[model samples]
Target chain A: MIQDMKPEDIIGDYKETLLDLYGSICRVVLYTDIETPYPDGKLIVSTTDKNGIITHVNKSFVEMSGYTEAELINAPHSILRHPDMPPAAFKDLWDTVNRGEKWQGFVKNLRKDGGYYWVKATVIPNIRHGEVVSYTSVRRKPSRTKVDECIKLYPTLF
Target chain B: MSYLFTVSPDFTPVHLSGWYIFNTWLQRQSGSPIHLEMYNDFPTQRLAIHNDQVDLIFANPFDAAMLVREKGFLPLVKAAGVSDEAIIAVRADSAVEDVAHLSPGITVAVTEDPDVTMMGMIMLEAGDLNAGNVETTIFDTYVLVAKNLLNDSADVGIFLAEAYDDLSSIVKKQLKILVRSQISVIHHSLMVGPKLADRRDEIQALLLSMAEDDKGKDILKSLGFDNWVKVDDEDMEFMIDLMEALAT
Candidate 1:
């Protein structure tokens, strides 16, 4: 089992490499079903390119997403975007991280085979040399109450 | 997508507009867009820094000194050439010709600007006059100081050496410097947050090369600066010392 730790809990840099065009998100699927609950004390770490392409994922993340390393290595981060997840939530995420600030929110991500999991994720600017080269995200099991609150508020962002 | 570019609120909005060209150029060079921000008060800007709401700032000496000492901000670059100083100017026709000839109780106009205030204080001290010795009127900017001085509201104007340069020609002919500040006037610092430290070399290179580009020359001219050079830590230290003295 991958060590039950946070990304900050992991020592040293988490490496990933995915370079997609800045924007190429066309798939929009919203499933009505709210699926499995992410367990306590588990963190899913992922890194994205400047364009939000999935470049790297930790073992815990891979197991949770049910995608092999090859399936996610160059996919858009939106591949994990869940339908019930509010667009406003992601908008807030972009707004915060775009300003080079860290943003934390409840995210509901989809799996490769149509399963889903909810997490409270923190996105930090991976700034190198006064510029944001990419973003590093660490997601942990979120409380049911907080996820419920976000679920109620997410759709209003659109 | 864009970084907040804050300037001291001590400057009026009209004055703040002067950085548009430079800010745009920086956005292009750094690959980060910029949101222009200015404050009417220093404390508000200080709060933004504490909150990490600012990525870069064009700060006056006093505030810059405080931020550098307190925050982990990196002083990236400064204007390339020309000396920045403060001066005590009198109406050309005034009988008071120099610092030594002035007597106590004469009114002097100065801004609350840290740079102007510090320089004025230093020059006043040199003339054996402190705030107690003179009737001082503090405005928000040196431009206001010059206005009050010309209107006969004050006997002397204490302002930036460059403000005198920007004056209307007729206004220019009406004032003469009675005392120039020898105290090292702190240069403007283009500072970056700690998060940007890794990109220091890239930012510095872009700034240093700004004047070399054809379009950059125009931008620099409009901003009243010639070029940008890597920051000098000695000057940074002096500014810190100045602020420290003020605190004590």
Candidate 2:
């Protein structure tokens, strides 16, 4: 039902505010200190409505998030936000795709069981008639060099 | 053995790679070999700078100044004819007319460098707007800042003034500069380490001559500069100011 809205309807100010509130309140389930990086050549894909509520997800995204398809659809994409990811980085991501450009960066995602995974992700605006109505994100296993760089840099950004 | 060459990813790889032609010229000039590296993340770069692995580096003015002051490095040359100014951009149709005109809830886009982004914030504060004058968003590169304004993700964007010529015509047509600043900024610089002290004058002379000839001009233009100029003490004063502000 949410995905069926017109572009203006989709940008409802209340939904943007609600997601921000929801992101602050949500908690992740705790697990051991396991860090599994998705193997090279595998992609985790997901699409969210203009408000960032998940509308479609691929098998890889489901596996990495550790949430079933049923559990993920209609959920806020923030479910995968890792504690280590800086708010500024997300600000950059939103600032990029919202401008109708593709944003590529290193991301650390929180799994359903509270484990963490890192990937190099690119998010692009899905535009129709010059209006962005949704966003599509594809994440892939990050190279060791990028991961090494992120580990040293992310601490300060947070 | 190859000489070590390093450059900061101040500009994006997609827009232009800092090391591309300069590395080739440096290698061809010296002729043993050269290993060039680009470091964008600041922390890792800090470690590398302190490790003494870098023989020569191209970096933003403030960082080059810091390295010269604290790390026993020597300032060599910079791209001539650029003020290295950063500008604040807004949608052509946006109601915001100036810094003071910015209302609450407006978003300001910027590049990720703390020093550069803070410079924009400082100027905004000087315009009588408080810290929360607008939402600031950090992009990985300066070129993308203008894209934020064109797309309506931001009402204002602060980006390198030198890069304005590189924006697509469509995006360029839709934006206007609401503010411009030559203060709190430095152009790019090439600096040499202490190990290369004996060869500094020779290297600087060669690099300067490269920007004067036709073929070398082509290389320089491709690297996003018109010519190379020797760095003088006066050229570093702004960087000193920037360092002081960053320290606080």
Candidate 3:
């Protein structure tokens, strides 16, 4: 449905308000136990504006998310955010990136088909002239041991 | 959250420490954590602005257009009685005495200060010259542009008028100005982004009264300003519109 909508229809002037509305507008959760293994030796890369609006995503990212470019551009990065993720992990990620630092974690991401995949995500602030501009995120296949640790650790924190 | 503040990179070296002092004063005055970040060039600074890293800025007329129109930044104040103008110069011994005498294919050296470059190009129109006709080389700073002229690497140089005035007497002596822009309406302005919009009135009032005190006067002198004055919204809009026209 979002793909049928014009880009301008979803990209509004107020970024904060739109980010707040993304959950309700874009949520189509039909979760299954199907787990898609991360592609080998490939990176899923994406960049987002300071307000978390998706500016660019690589081919690997498009293939992994199973979404077309039209559905991703101007969409909030949170569209791929999994409901199973703990709030504390994201809070920590935001804190680190906001301080102009890099944050790395094993993340569970939701695919278009409501399947899930795990990634070793490293997010870095793209700075120019000593100012943090946008953010770049590089995701790779995560270690199964680390994913197993997170699967147990995330539940206690929540 | 600590807000980032920056000035246009065209400032002369003498005022570097003055900006630090001003930052200190502003933090104390506003009771907010403000950090000053200076870029060495326009492209890098513009990249930062494009990413929305800048919360407060003292920006040139050309950049002010993008900031106000596209980025939702509000003009807070401007240097009283000061305007941004461009100057076209050559080495004193050079045969070129007037802009009309300038020939095509002359190597023109310039910094990436957009407003000054725009004005310089407009002045070159008198010689029936345009960007296509002239060979232009971009330097990182006005000093480098001057160096290019003095070393015979460039036939002409473009400079910000204020920066030209701040040049040492020795450097000024070797340079001959063909023309200077007298458009007094365009100016650099301090603007606040949406993150700091709530404190806009408070910050504006603080800067307006700064010259009334001895401490603020000293700081203003170090920064080569007499005082900060309120910029009329209509005046700023007019300037931005003018810049948009020139850019197109």
Candidate 2 structure, TM-score to reference: 0.54
lDDT of 2 by residue, B1-248 (tens): 66677876565465345457768878888664767877767666777888878888877665765687678787788877754565667888888776656666777888766555654554454344435556778887656788777777877787766666568788878888766654423466788888887788988888889966787888887776788889855345434433442332
Colliding residue pairs in candidate 2: none
Best by lDDT: 3
Chain B TM-scores per candidate, in order, are 0.85, 0.83, 0.96
Predictions: Cα RMSD each: 23.1, 21.7, 19.5
lDDT of each: 0.69, 0.67, 0.80
Each prediction's TM-score against the native?
Answer: 0.55, 0.54, 0.60
Model 3 misplaced stretches (Cα beyond 4 Å) = A1-158
Residue range B102-166, candidate 3, lDDT tens digits: 88899999888888898788667556567999999999888889989999999999899988887
For model 2, how does the per-residue alpha-carbon lDDT over A61-124 read when each residue is reduced to its tens digit?
8877777899889987877766667788998988888788778888988666556788777787
- Which candidate do you rate higher for lDDT, 1 or 3? 3
| B18-39: candidate 1 lDDT, tens digit per residue | 6876788888888887788776
